[model samples]
Target: MSKTHFPLPVRQLAVFLSLLFSGYLLSCTASEAQSDTPPLNPNGDSELALLMRAMFDDAQAMKQQIKEGKTPRPSLDYEKILTAEATEPDKAASDTYKVHALSYLQTIKALQQADAAQAASLYENMVNSCMGCHKALCPGPTMRIKKLY
Candidate 1:
């Protein structure tokens, strides 16, 4: 028999990355709120609708876990927002979306790093970023996203 094992941190990073990707897929598939015809934005990228639903699903799950007094492990792959082909290429390249997305990402990072007492407020700010972006680009999902809080 041959046996090989990765170092602890490497293994942990692998598991975390796996969870981040799987969370996206699971979130998409598990969401019952998704409509058959996704609401496309002005740029006409319907693919982003599914991604948004997946994110919403993930956010809902995280909020639920926190409400249950559990520290939900961070599962976002910030790189996906940068690289995902489903998004509008031009919008991805836009400084406006990038700034809003970065704020959301930073809030998530803060929540991930925060102690329990601070997580709730950080989570609210994270959701606020979602609202801010939606208000500017895709207002249709604003109410749905707001419910994540």
Candidate 2:
């Protein structure tokens, strides 16, 4: 056929494959950059650990409100817990734990601000932080954290 060109569909497929491969390469590069970072331990019981624990406690209390058929208190004061954790992040088991602890505190605050449906969504994130940390440095409390969900 004297080198007849490929069809338009083949060109589109080639473009799509190229884009997909590029995305995968970028993701792999980003993941590799984070691979050397240390894991978190949310249950270490240091200051950050304590803050994470307190955050979880607050989350549980909110859940209890639902169970008891009561509204969550609007003045739960999540900032206090966050401030305490931020003030001394180095005391946490790891930097990742400190970061996640702070994030969990904010999530609790958001839950308080959100409607019941939104609050329920935040609950999953709270549990995820616990599981993420426990999977690395401290698996001891992972079971209890799972129960919270």
Candidate 3:
């Protein structure tokens, strides 16, 4: 059999690309779980919960489009929904909760700029951010958020 060799630079590029692909796959899988709709809020629907429920629906639509190899346009109301104050107050005014919420916004910005190649991954990251916040501030919805992945 003839010996085959790849040049050092070419091999390096291959390695880098492989690592990037692996990371993307891991990110996708890590968030992959069956997302179920959150149980109705016991205290009745708060404005924040309503906004999140709407956002989840929009995200699912975007995910479906991505799975179909289509580019998704960001929802026009996303920013407005995100920035609106919760009609019901959080249990506490903790910085950690605020950070997670901010991360969601930043992830949305990333999704807004995503191309076809990047949209799915960005969407996964955004979902993960939602899960992270819920884990801290409202563990009840964690499983539901996981399904978004």
Candidate 4:
């Protein structure tokens, strides 16, 4: 039998290199999996948070349709915005939040009925109501919601 032995330093270097390469690969994988979707709340997402994400996705599609001079379709039953559970119950249960939620629904209804020409204006109003509610209850989302415009 013939045996070939690597020097101790050479073996240690190989181990270190293997670990370094593994770390780099893992980091790349993690970065690739990252998405534009917002991170979940520390306490996990509430029903309202998930609905808002669906709303945002729908709004993006609607905005594209509007840009192409097509009518924006409302796919979500948005009345849930008023009753959906919130990550923070204290904030969502407030009278102010209720008012904002109602106003948002009104704007959404108006936008849904808008003609092609009026869709843009009504859409803007709808987005404004969203921002307004965010501003009143949680300002963190106002910036993200602005991208809807």
Candidate 5:
């Protein structure tokens, strides 16, 4: 058998370099694993986000009540939508957004005033209101809001 040989000092140096390179690679991987995730907002979600989440819940309940032919007196003060501060304050300040918010509120009010016989359509209108506003302003929730139908 033939053996490849290196001088003792050269072999030790190669071994030392291999160990050092392995340690560097391991440290790099560890650092990558510890990379920071998104930081939570210190002040928490905007009032508008919170309000919308509540509205979504109320709508879900109302939808169920509607299916059962029961009147849904959703207690959520949807008017708060106008005054609530949004996550992106600039978007809330726009004229287009104001109109959308008013449109959404009107749909909710209509849904509330309608009889059970008219509720399915009114509820559909309400969902459409959300869809329209979200589609124009924030498309992120559009898919989720579609499930309301």
Candidate 6:
């Protein structure tokens, strides 16, 4: 015996398409979310200090990688620190804080792209961004940001 298949109803097809579209959107959002680094704590002294130290450490490591002609390992800890900072409670100026972290990440990406001069330029901007944030949120790190150069 032969079997016949019927076409799906238009409403069902629309629903399926809607679900597929939603899934696609969500996947894109998830990937973007994964790429973002969290903000550092704007208030915790120890946490801010640690993150500031990590930022310098990561910068040094990136420099060392360039000097040794090796690919730098990504700093996963920095991302976590930034995430925590970005999500901290009572963050009235969180948007500005996030901009600083993002600037540093952008500079790092430029460094990874192999343009030494452009990367160097971005490095100063990155330091500036950090300084700008630290000046208000964690003043103690102002000197540390200067040392990163």
TM-score of each: 0.63, 0.48, 0.65, 0.72, 0.73, 0.49
| C-alpha RMSD values across all candidates | 21.6, 15.8, 21.0, 7.3, 7.1, 16.4
lDDT ranking of the models: 4, 5, 3, 1, 2, 6
Better-scoring candidate (TM-score), 3 or 4: 4
Model 2 deviation from native, Cα RMSD in Å: 15.8
lDDT value, candidate 1, whole model: 0.75
Winner by lDDT = 4
List candidate 1 stretches off by more than 4 Å.
1-47
lDDT by candidate, in order shown: 0.75, 0.64, 0.77, 0.89, 0.87, 0.63
Tens-digit lDDT track for model 4 on 9-85?
Answer: 89999999999999999998888668445456767789999999999999888899899999999899899987899
Q: Sort by TM-score, best first: what order?
A: 5, 4, 3, 1, 6, 2
Number of clashing pairs per prediction, in order: 0, 0, 2, 0, 0, 7
- Cα misplacement distance, residue 99 of candidate 6 (Å): 2.8
What candidate 4 gets wrong by more than 4 Å, as runs, is 1-39
Worst 10 residues of 1 by lDDT: 32-41
Q: Candidate 4, residue 110: CA error in Å?
A: 0.7
**Top candidate, metric TM-score:** 5
Candidate 5 lDDT tens digits, 1-149: 22578878899999999999999999998887689553334567889998998989889999899889998767798989889999889999899899998998888888879988888998998899888888888998888888889
Q: Please provide, for model 3 over 52-115, each residue's C-alpha lDDT reduced to its tens digit, 9 standing for 90 to 100.
A: 8888888888889899988876684655544555644654346776688778889889998889
Better of 3 and 6 by lDDT: 3
Instruction: Report the number of backbone clashes for model 2.
Output: 0
Better of 1 and 3 by lDDT: 3
